[model samples]
Structures are given as C-alpha cells and as structure tokens.
Target: MRCQPERGHLVYIWTKNNQFCALCDEPSGVERDLCGPCEDELPWLHDQCSICALPLLVDGMACGECLQRPPAFTRVETPWRYDFPLDALVTRFKHQGKWPLGRLLADGLARHLLHAYGEGLPRPDCLLPVPLAKRRLRQRGFNQATLLARWLGAQLQLPVDEQLLRRTLETPPQQDLDAATRQRNLRKAFALSHQVELRGRHVALVDDVLTTGATTQSLARLLRKAGAARVDVYCLARTAKPGD
Candidate 1:
C-alpha cells in the first residue's frame, strides 16, 4: 500500500546561519534548505499511473484516460503531489518570484531523479524546459521551468536546451479547463526550432507541475514528430483528480 504524509506533523523551528528549513525555519544542517523531519512530512506521490503519474489506486498501472489514448511521452517522474505546503511553495516561486523556494524544490527534484536513475531510469540525452508564452513570461518576469531545468542540469551534469521549444499561442490556463478542452486549447500552441537535430535523441521536459498534462502531451507530440527517440516528463509535483 502507498503511504501518504500524515497531516499535522509537528514543525520544529530554530535559528541558524548556515541553512534553514523552508517550512519551519529550523536549522537544516544540510546543503538543502529542507530538514529531515519536514522532508519526511512532504506530500510525496505514491501509488500512481505509470504513464502520466496521476494518483491511482494501484502502482505501475496506466490510468483509464492514458489507456484509452496514450500520451506522446513515455512516462512522467514527479516526487510530490500538488497538496498542502507544496502548492503554497510553488505559488510563491511561480507567482511571487521566490527564487530560493523554487531552488529548494528543484534541488529535491534533482535528488529524486538521481535515485530514479540509480534504479535504472534511462538518463535523457538532453533537458528541454517547457517554454512559457511571451506575455506570461513578461508578466512573471521568469519561467519557473527554465530555472528548474537549469538547476537540474547543473546537479545532474546534463545539457539543458531552452531554445528547442517555443510557445506560439497564448492559451488560457489549463487549470480553468477540463481535460478535453485543455487538449484542444493546446493545439498548434507550440513550435519547435528547426535548426536543432533531435533524431534518435532521448529528451526530458522539465516543468514545475503536471496538472492535466495537456501541455506536456502537446509538447511531447511535437518532439516525437521531430524524431526524438524517447520523451519523458520531469516535474516537481503532480496534481490529483478533484476529490481523489
């Protein structure tokens, strides 16, 4: 059985100069800002769909939607569920421009990927961060995915190519739409750079969160058509279905 973070875990607070927990302001005593106890209480993703990584009753099985129509990507790898403190942290990083909070989350993701690699997950040839629409980028002042990809690249010793994909159309937020509408909204929404050669290359798309996964599906379709041998998604969090 999959385990979930026990809510209401006590948070410890302390003052230190070296490192402090992002959640409790306690001394981390490690390179990362998150301490052990707080890390243990994180909303880790457990039983999930093998393809899209959606929360599921059983592990290593495809969800109904994925079985009916498979996504362009092979698999999704995310460490957390978009719940509790994670959602708030992501908001601070993505909306409020808290780079440190984003960095902490990215660091945790890097460690997760490394463990996955150790467990035989194939390392991708390159990393491509999902691009943001020009208007959204202007409004946000930065792309969280780009920062995540860069940080992951540095930690994993992989190459990050931010120029490979471009968001051509500014679509409404996927959160506001249902699954079907989300797919339609992403149609012709992304364009790939023709200059780069991707034939037979294994690439992973980096992003902050995977909600409906419509965005990654659209991007993966484009990459597969462009001759990428394999496509995977690397995101910090995966959201569950409503009331799941």
Candidate 2:
C-alpha cells in the first residue's frame, strides 16, 4: 500500500512489514521498503523534455538539442533526477557491490514503469539491458544493468534478451567526456548478436542512469539498423545537462 505524507508524517499507514529505510535506517512505516520521509524526499523529475527526459523550464516541450537532432531512441522514461540520496544510492549499488541497494532501486523503477504503462506508455516487445564490455564485465564480476533488467523484467512480466546487444569496444567512461567526444568514442562500440531478429519489434533499453545518453543512442542506432521499429529508454535517474 502507498502512504501519502503530510507535514513529514505518514498520513495513511498500512501493513507492518518492518522494513527499514535504506537511507536513514529508520523503520519504514509504510508497505514499501522506504519510509514515508525518504519516499517524500526522493528527487522526483518533473517538467522534462518528452524525447530526452532532460529537466526543462516547461513541461511537455522538447529540448533544443532534441529538436535540432533527435537521438535514436524515440522516448525516455526516468523517475528521478540524478542528485542527492539517489546519486549516492546508485554509486553504492554500481561500484560498491551493494546488491540490496540495487534491488531496492530497481523495485522503485519498476513501480514507476507500471504507473507509466497505466498512463498509456507503450510497452516494448522486449527489454535489453545496456551491455557492458568484456573487460569491464570481467573486472566487475557482474553487469549492473543486467541485474536491473532482470529485476524489472520479472516485475513487469516482460521478456528480457541479455544477449541481443553486445558492447564491441572498451570505451572509457562517458562521465568524464564531453558530449562530442562521448558520441565519437561510442561510434563503433556496439553490435547486434548473430541470429537475433529485431524486425518490426519495439525494444526498451534499460540502464542504471542516463547522463549524456551517448551510450543509449549508440545501442539504439544499432538496434534500428537490425530492424527495430521503435526504441525507448528506461533508466533509474537522468542527470541534468551541464549548466542547465
């Protein structure tokens, strides 16, 4: 059950699962794992671009960059802005090997996606987690995107193809690169697996966070070339554009 907060207190409480808030370690007084205060403090996104999901001055308007040159993906759905506790949670989940934190974040994202689907967002035929390069996968011992995709697929009852997309090159992290360089670095970084047919299929690309969207765009282009009819991106958070 959902708890609507009023003046920092839970207005409606249901269930007593005794789950503790991942952030503050306080008892979660609601049905969900997060306590009412933490839930209320999530960095929710609003007034964003329809195509890129970038925070905008006004809602339902495409960002200037998107209007001039739209990316391969047709739409993006992200529930939170990349900031504060959300950023800390993602960093811990991705780099520190915190599986519980990752699972919690995935659960929240799945709920948001279900709500969006209820509000008429088109569901994709299959889900593809943004793949990790062989070197990184070996170094990390697991792919965070793959884990998130698995959880979300289970929650949504959607098919997930982990082998459909493969990263061909070990490019540097896009976080440190500028937009132009990021795009150039990822130009030939992805490939479609052999014997995979995407013809007339809609695919959702899943990832942990979307910063500049270079990686997603690269994979989306490859999917389109392999005959995907539509590409949509799903992520936990979206980082605001620099200086926006």
Per-model C-alpha RMSD: 10.1, 7.8
Model 2: per-residue Cα lDDT over 74-146, one tens digit each: 9999899999999999999899899888998999999999999999999999899999989888888899999
- lDDT tens per residue, model 1, 180-225: 8999999999998656788999999999999898899999999999
> Which regions of candidate 1 deviate over 4 angstroms?
1-16
- Candidate 2 — which pairs collide? none
Compute each candidate's TM-score over C-alphas. Answer: 0.91, 0.91
Candidate models: Cα lDDT each: 0.92, 0.91
Worst 10 residues of 1 by lDDT: 8-17
